[model samples]
Target: MAALQKKQSINCKVLVLGKSGVGKSYILLQYTAPPQEIVQMPKLTTVGVDYKYGTEKIEDTEVKMSIWDTAGQEKYRPIIQTYFKNSKAAILVFDLTDKQSLQDVRYWLREVKLQCGKDVAKILVGNKCDLPHEQPDQALIQEYCEEFQMEYIESSALQKINIQEIFVKLAKKIYQQHKASIPQNQLKQNSLPANEAQNQNSTSSNKQISLKNSKPKQKKENDGCC
Candidate 1:
């Protein structure tokens, strides 16, 4: 029989779902790599569902995440939902230049909720934010996010703007959720009994009084006189 390995870090699954050509793969690539290194890799694309592994430290604890970038085509929708099985967090990416892409995120959001349940943490990403000219309606996006109680942010994969912040934000939220899930009683460390501390103080005071009342033995000299 083989001995089981001890677990040191927590594992989290994060899903990136959006319409095709919304830079879902690009976001993951940029997040996992330096901007200068992956700058020329524009043609990178995920077919059905591509998995990327990355480790991030949330404060003192390390979190290993399997980031799943799902194909955004309608035909691949069924297959994409399967990857949502054990996802702890999800990012709904949309292209800033394409309004339809933003609107399509609603469908993906519904699918995520249905498949992954409502407890999964979700963040809305408006990618390609550095593009010139056209942009999604900020007010409308704010309304949607507020309505669904989802966090929203604008990111530019090419410019590397808010790229790292996205993951850090996600990691923080996931860590918080993990902490919240633990039983309250389990989170507290060992505590002394109600009277244990008070009793110790009382005992110390009695000891001091006993020492204070002790008198030098003069009885030995008096015994000789008896």
Candidate 2:
């Protein structure tokens, strides 16, 4: 994920929903903030909800996402819960080194379901994967996502591992989820020359907009495709 570039028409609200100390702030900072401006938060705890606006160039598609970094502690839940209604997608992060964090996925998933739009794209993220410790079992991760109806990925914000992917992949999912809302003219093939449009029409057109359509696939086995 690149830093915020010139604004684009493709936009959506992405809520970074997770527990405290799950590296949500660092993840957002690394993905969105430019090097010179990076501010290290000592406490690493959000008071309520923080907002960041940035553009990501994903497989040629430029997406301007309004990232809402929410406070994960119990007391601040109400203050941050309001934004769930407008959130187009969610990145539910958990501390990978903390097994208890994995168990808390249910509360966050249910919270999104209760407050977000019915079709909101939800992904469960396991942060700090680079740490040397007993990692989450692959089977358990799969089983959990199936029960919650969301996707999951392990990342280390400090190491910059899978930081960009977390957003790029989820952005793609959100793009596809709200595709019907996009104007016909913005669809790649529509803006092409007649000859080009004719050629593109012969192939799977949406694959052009959603880069992943041409690729293998992603994490959440049961979260369904993007």
Candidate 3:
């Protein structure tokens, strides 16, 4: 079998938003991977916003992701919303074992749309999927995803289930969004060189005309000599 090759990466910003204790930071750490040692779970809650830099290879494109893990506590909600300013994609997580966490998904979804703008690509993540027997209806989650037009995935940051898949899929969405804009940008750039050349030529011609007009007329031999 041919070996899969990684592509050159481009920088992109992705935001992770959810209620506190939903393991949003863990999700980022799962991908970031701390030195292959036994790593203790972080007890500290995210303050305003936490950032981790990582890369994800989706097909031929490598996305150098600026993954922002935002504070999910209500007190920090306002502060967290500011991180949404530059986000191209978002992962809105909910704890699968906590019913209230599931409920809060709706509120978070609303905030993401309002603050990040309607065009931002989003995924609804049901985290802590390894927990046994959750009451939060899978059907309800599916329906919410369908209604919001967001991708839905179950992930366990602790067990590392579907962790990479979450980022890969979100990165794909971001990549597609960026890819869609390429043609218009290319069109603008392609048109620029010709337009610039035309302007330069016009300016040069105008300068020559102005010089000729400003010069004193040559004295004709048969006419009055200057």
Q: Compute the lDDT of residue 10 as modeled in candidate 3.
A: 63
How well does model 3 score by local distance difference test?
0.80
Candidate 2, lDDT over the whole model: 0.76
lDDT of 1 by residue, 1-226 (tens): 3233233367999999899998989889888876567747668667789888888788656878899988988998777777788888888899988999988988988887888888777788999888874857888788768766678889998777898888878877787788788778644421234365456557999999999999987755565584
Best by lDDT: 1
Clashes of each: 0, 0, 0
Per-prediction TM-score to the true structure, in the order listed: 0.76, 0.72, 0.73
Candidate numbers sorted by TM-score from highest down:
1, 3, 2
**Which candidate wins on TM-score?**
1
| lDDT by residue for model 3 (123-170), tens | 889898888955678787887788777898889988889998998888
Query: Residues 179-210, candidate 2, lDDT per residue (tens digit)?
Result: 66667767664446566566566566666657
Candidate 3 local Cα displacement, residue 213, angstroms: 28
Question: Model-by-model lDDT, in order?
Answer: 0.81, 0.76, 0.80
lDDT of 1: 0.81
Error of 3 at 179 (Å): 1.6
Model 1 regions lying over 4 Å from their true place: 1-8, 34-36, 190-226
Q: Alpha-carbon error at 80 in model 2, in Å? A: 1.4
